[model samples]
Target: MKKHIVNLWAFIHLVAHRFATDGVAQTAASLTYTTLLAIVPLITISLTIFSAFPAFQTVSTNLKIFLLENMLPESAGKVISVYMFQFSENAGKLTAIGTVILAITAFLLMQTIEHALNGIWHVRRARPWTQRLLIYWAVLTLGPVLIGGSLYVTSYFTSLTLGLGHEVHGATLYGLKFTPILLTVTAMSLLYLMVPNRYVMARHAWLGGLVAGVCFELMKTLFSNYVSHLPSYTMVYGAFAILPLFLLWIYLSWMVLLLGAVITAMLPQYAQGAMAGEQRVGYQFDLAVRTLVQLSHAHLRGEVLSLVQLVKLTHIHGEMLEQVLISLQDGHWVLRTNQGWALARHPDKILLRELFERLVFDAHHAQLDLGVIVRQPDLNLSDWVRSSAQLKLGEPCR
Candidate 1:
């Protein structure tokens, strides 16, 4: 029990630290603005898809109710739902070019979300625009249809069970009440798994999704209560209250979503760092040298070192390991492969002095600009750098 308590505290600390460092507030605010721009177009596109199916057409109102109820606080949900219904109705009057533009605008929202998720994972690479366009198009087109199908199936089952018997119907109703939570978790898991370029463990994705789903439900309940009791928005803005209230809710929703992402990205590091008793040691020359040597040995032996393997072997936090690996790749000292990292050149060609100069000394000098000012006449920086390299990389491999 004590150990579990310690682990929980450590997890919270790591998440708080990363949440601030990753600038989640800024990212969430940006997403909130983008979402507002795309919301109408996205809803129009989804409603269009729903209308294409005769079965879904009859129950579209129910679908809208479900979405609004689960997604927004009560009063805000009602306001947004009325506006969305009107907008979706008018969307059919648009020209071909306007429709195309509307679809692209909806895709922009997904693109922005992808960028934010990638930032959290420290992913520098991005899919090509052509690939992204196809992916995002499919999501925008098929996503609504799939959701409508699911809702249809659920409703069918509920009605069927009701006709059969009361006992079974009661159980079905109880299970259906949790549908919002299930859907939220499933969507969040997929987002975490697919948005970032890096591979996320399934367990981590599901755990993060579960946390986000629970928080979302709780927030909806709390916000609705607050809005109902507080009359502040209505008093201040009068008829215009819904607009600002909607914006505030969207901003808060994005903040919650990004917080879940932070938790997912940092979970591996927090778990391992706690066990290893790791702290912010920053970048040390010795640590870098050791990391390179390990990768070098694995490469020579035809062994692939995974991120988890490297973390365990080095007893280093995953984030720090990623940072070191990225720095090595940038300097052409290492190359990343599908399996893992490998040496860019033969170990023999990688001199200890040169490695240290590229990875450590250069980084330090860049930050401090030590070369910009004249040092004391007796001080010899080059000799000191070489000696430090030798001490860190004694008996160089190769």
Candidate 2:
């Protein structure tokens, strides 16, 4: 118990240090700034679109009040409000001219957002030009349309509920109580549908979105009613008061976005592989092992290795490790001898080892040097005729 506790503490400390490192801090700050900039444009772009349609303009106003006006810093709220006011005025005249310009700006903003978020998701932009065009169109054109429809549906429900409440209890409880929840659900669903790159399961997305949306709406309401009531920072920080508030709001918004992603990702795993199609093993051992075996077999045609050594050195479990070895042996990539396993000498195993070592090294040090740890004699192996699958980059075989 003591040993486990000590190890756990050490691990946690290491993680903290890793994140607290200058590079990590700088990266985090950069992402935060990028996200904040993206949010303003994204919100403005959406509002501009809704303002083009008279019926949807009212919905946009409600959304703005709910999301941005109520939650943002007073300065930011003022800036956005003024901009939207100008947009509303121009939107009332020469519909297509302003609309077209705003549409182009929104599309550009979406692409910018996509580029940033895609990096965070670790997904590559593999689609060609035509596909990119289609995807962008779907996000920019179809997105607002969907939101408009949802808002209309919500308004209808609100009216029906309010009418029923008045008739039954002589109070508007149902509409007042349920409207926020309905709005939250709508917002969450939109986020889930719009945010991710790879395909997300609908059920998980919906549940996550709903939960996050509800929490966000509640927080917005609470913040507006309580936080906004607090005295302005001018007395506290003087001229710099609004700065901290803006930063705080930015941080809070980022936290909300992260929480939404986490909840959505976790929902599929809530029941421990019940929802996911195939449960991959911890750390993706099977994948790593397959790659290891393939590289070894490709390079060392008759390299011999003890099963015990393979298991210990590769950190693979006994059964799965044996299966891999047996597979390689059966395939004639390796030969079983009395002493150890032997394989035909190919050059690829060395390349595989180098690749694996690089991965391990990167995992440990994300770029930090650990003194002589990587240069130690124990880990530094030279070449051998019988040393199958032992390859080193830029080092001659001994």
lDDT of 1 at 165: 72
TM-score of each: 0.78, 0.51
Which segments of candidate 2 are over 4 A away from where they belong? Answer: 1-83, 87-101, 124-126, 157-176, 193-195, 236-247, 266-398
lDDT for each residue of candidate 2 in 122-208, tens digit (9 for 90 to 100): 343333456656777777656666666666666666678677765423344565456556655665565555555534456756776
Model 2 superposed RMSD (Cα):
12.6
Q: After superposition, how far is residue 251 of candidate 2 from its true place, in Å?
A: 4.0
TM-score of 1: 0.78
lDDT tens digits, residue span 1-398, model 1 = 99888888878887888899989999989998998888889988888888888989855776787878788788888878888878877876899998988888898899999899989988766777887787677777767776787788778887887788765546676778887788888778778877776667788889898898888888889899999999988888999999988888888888888888888888777655543444433245556777888887897798878776776677665566777888878878888887777788878887766555664454443433333222333557786565445343343222
> What are the RMSD figures for all models against the true structure?
7.4, 12.6
Clashes of 2: 14
lDDT of 2 at 161: 68
Q: Give the number of the best model, judged by lDDT.
A: 1
Most accurate candidate by TM-score = 1
Per-model CA lDDT versus the true structure: 0.78, 0.52
